[model samples]
Target: MTEIIDYGRFADRLAAPRPRWDLLREFQDEWGYTVPAGVDPWPKWSESEHHAYVRALHEEWTGEEEDPFQGVDRTLPVPKALDEWWDLPFNSFTYSPRLYWTNPEYPLTLRPDPSGYGVSEGLPEPNPFVEPGGDLRLCCFMAEYEYCNEWAYLASEAGHDDPRVLASVGEDGWVLQARSISEFFVLLAAVRLPSHFGWSVQLGDDDFPDGPPVRERIEAAYRPMGFQNWRELGADTALFGGPDVIVRHDTGMADFAVEISGRSRDALAATARTLGWTWDEDLVEPPRKDEESQ
Candidate 1:
């Protein structure tokens, strides 16, 4: 019979170099796994308790000497599956990106381009809610893997109620919603315009010039709706190739195609105007007709 170790306490002690080594030996004996000597076991540890332990150890090493882990139990009940769960990083092994199909014939695919970069493909036909000849595409900006998962879950749940909302799961395990220019703008505004909500935005490849006019328009549109500071919420990643404007907030991020046009363009512009947005000719584009027949 295996003796159950108090995981919480084990995690606390496992932060120290000496304790960490001893814990590894204990694991090796208890679970029959080889722990390489001299490795920083903290980084490999998965539980929140382990993270706390590592953080404590770091503080001690830095002479901070704050026992942040004080009052935390040194041991807690270890799940029988603990070894299995710890075998690999939790996020690495379990995170799945999938597009649940409302229409089975239109299965999505993850295709790598010539450069070996992969993107989600197989978008279904445009939603009729979008005016004819309108452009429909969505660009999702994700920094953390977990956020991507959240987006996927939200989108999947939304799609069940709204067939107009289509999603494709990317190789990176993100659900990229296939949305019309209008739908994308609406969703963007919905998330950004709300006062308590947090999100970020960037210009997509389809956006041009990416100048102040566009930025001003977005800011004005989102401000009255209660959007926080656009600049501070924006991401600094090269993904947007340095968007003319970036909006960052607490929960999610978006890449805006400011210059794209479709029947929904007027609706998008209207929404912006309603939010007090002002834009120049360069920041606007004539709406295009659906070229599906062409």
Candidate 2:
């Protein structure tokens, strides 16, 4: 039987060393950044409570279900250095599922066997000591990985194991994606924007010099809508905000193509007018007509 530990107290001690990651601000500054309306800040679950929840999960696995927790040498020990992680409120700018760890709607428990990354699902069988095999130590319930059990964000229990690594138990074998939690953040921040959003950039050229006129107009278009990708519109054309952005140079001001709906589009268009740029509402018309002919 695993003994319950004081997770909250441990988290307090660990908080001192954890990096002060302002993920929200970083996400907002990136181009094509968007978040849902009901965003709550971090520390969603208290450490003591969440650890109790995890222990309960272990009980469920070991009780009647077939002892999924059996024979794994690597136990999910509360690490002295990483107790702060359990207290973090998981929030991704675009994706909502990252926040589902404590969400009542999704449920907090993880099921093994076919539904999870288990031996039946291409993972290696369990061993006496926890080896990098079988299901990844479930960190949080990501909606993206709900269906697939191949890969997940894993926090190794043993101090000898990679402190924080993304482990994958695929058809090939167990592979680690990120070497450390710091490396994982870099990977998470670099995820591509979803296809639904349109991307384009405005630039000042001979026709529209990079001056107050251009800046003010861009502001009028972008600022009022609360679109916070201002760094992309900064003085330098060379710097790219992200993949979902358009970049323009010093010869002519190019029109922006936005995928937002209704009044937002109107506002952006109105702002473009300040720089003498026209919004071609009919640009998509020709393509639609062609598709209709087909």
lDDT of 1 by residue, 1-294 (tens): 134332223323334445222333343233222333333333222323333465577777887754332422223222222233224331111121111101110011112112111133322345433344543332222212222221111222222322223333343332333222122222332222211111122235334344455445444433221222121123211111011122222222434433221123344344434333454556554422222101
Candidate 1, which ten residues in sequence have the lowest lDDT sum? 97-106
Determine the backbone clash count of candidate 2.
6
lDDT for each candidate structure? 0.28, 0.32
Model 1 stretches astray by more than 4 angstroms: 1-254, 257-269, 289-293
User: Where does candidate 2 have its weakest 10-residue lDDT segment?
Assistant: 230-239
TM-score for all models, in order of appearance: 0.20, 0.35
